[model samples]
Target: MSRRLVPLALTLALGLAPVVAVTTGATAGQAERRAAPSRTVDLPDGWQPEGVTTGRRGKVYSGSLADGSILRLNPRTNRTVVLPDSAVGKPSVGLDYDKRRRILWVAGGPEGEIRAVRLGTGEVLRTYTLPAAANDRFVNDLVVTSGAVYATDSANQELGVVELPAGLTLPPSGAATLLPLTGELVYQDGFNANGIVESNRGNWLVLVQSNTGRLFRVNAATGRTLQIDLDGRRVRNGDGLEAKGDLLYVVRNANNRIDVYDLKRNVRSGDRVKVIRTPDFDTPTTATVVRRSLWVANARFGVDDPETASYWLTRVDR
Candidate 1:
């Protein structure tokens, strides 16, 4: 079996603070202020939370490594319950829910399997094995829309879109092959696009290079791509990305921080720049903005110790 090799393609940015002030539309001004930071809830013993998503009812579903389980964190009751245990048999990297079907989809992890589990009865309704020429390929992070699920392939250096049909099987066709990242433009060691999120503008997909910290915008209709960051330099080890309205939140892995960029604030060459930096994080790997608050998954594994990995979930006020 093939395994991924590590390379020093990351940089650390430290001692920075939020510097940009955002002015929004008149209607947005009337909206309430973003929520304040909340107390971090440590997971139960052996429950290593990796990814988080909010359910239709505002409940938080945290993906855990302990038993490959999803846990519903009920803050009001101060209780956690293992949910959608069908995920227990699979290695789940990222978790997101489809409100229309009430199905929870988890990106493939070590096993390269994407699963759709019914939240109502905790049954795995379907599974899709990633098709790859490389044996070590796996799905990293994913974003689900009304029609399809777009997942990033770290090992194979590709992007895959899995369509959701009734009964949910891997589509017989319609998988997309993204434009290859090569030459001096490619970030990381051969296009390791680890994190993926939809553009705040709601039309494009933002793919982050884990090793190089470069961001690329992928066209939804055509697989054609453009580098969002023109410099081809590291912004921090870009791990996971989350877009809440016009703001894009990115997890800076090497720096152990979360950085926010305003999509509307373009400074040079029509590219958005990082404006806020929140440090004091431990290998912060992925972020999700829910309930007007930002949640981070601290993987706790960095350049210092890439072999051993552990994680916890934390929240920050916007």
Candidate 2:
């Protein structure tokens, strides 16, 4: 589901802290040498961004929920550019950059559409309309793999799959398929499958259940799932997921924090290694690691007004 529509009263009911310190043991000098200089990059007012991904040459990409426009940010130079209108007009929730094909796969929230945009020219190459009943689908996030692209439907119990042809060629429209989720994972009242990532060397896909605060390991081919044990810790309100080697980062939206987990070799279990919190986070929805730092997109849900409110990206040193 698009979190922008979640009521403000529900957010207040969570009683999340406004700030939580990120603890580290390294000396100040050592930390400064290892970490990049922390900073913020302001987005267009009312951008209402939810997703973030890093591209070649240190370029950071995010999509605006308000207009479906894609914004490109160069953190090093602090420059910004808005992509063409070919992919605009639909809410863009999550996106991934395809290095092999130089395409940016964007999830069309509530529209049940996935668009492939050329990274260099901003031309929308193709828009695939996922098969689902009207008003019953919310294409939340997507992850690209070697042979296919998998997307989550926050409002349903199935995943939208787009199989790429040989040579990583984009498939024709109406070629997408649906993979029904089975096993321990269940769809609840609110958002169910929100974020997805491939782990265990691409043998397993890890998914976060937003409403239940549970992580599940899914068989990519069979769609069978098993709940991941998180050492009794729950990542409630988890929105976007990022996996780096054996480490997984879960962005807990309402809590204003990101939880890092150390996953086991089989990806069936994990231990919470750290909690990343900052005052700058205003309902951060997703993140991408760049040069030892995490660039987070603040969705700022529940603000008094979204159309005129300020929006920005917070760069936290990991």
Please give the distance, in angstroms, between residue 61's alpha carbon in candidate 1 and its true position after superposition: 1.5
- Assess candidate 1 and give its lDDT: 0.60
lDDT against the true structure, per candidate, is 0.60, 0.83
After superposing candidate 1, which stretches have Cα over 4 Å from the reference? 1-38, 75-78, 165-191, 200-202, 230-233, 265-280, 302-311
- Of candidate 1, the 10-residue stretch with the lowest lDDT total is 1-10
Question: Candidate 1: deviation at residue 13, Å?
Answer: 20
Q: Give the TM-score of candidate 2.
A: 0.89
TM-score of decoy 1: 0.74
Q: Candidate 1: deviation at residue 273, Å?
A: 7.2
For candidate 2, write residues 4-101 as lDDT tens digits. Answer: 43355756554333333233787756544644345678998888899899988779998889978889998888899888653467788898988898
Error of 1 at 136 (Å): 1.5
Tens digit per residue, CA lDDT, model 1, 199-294: 656467777776666677776566556666544445546777877766777776655556666555331213345433333355566776667666
TM-score of each: 0.74, 0.89
Best by TM-score: 2
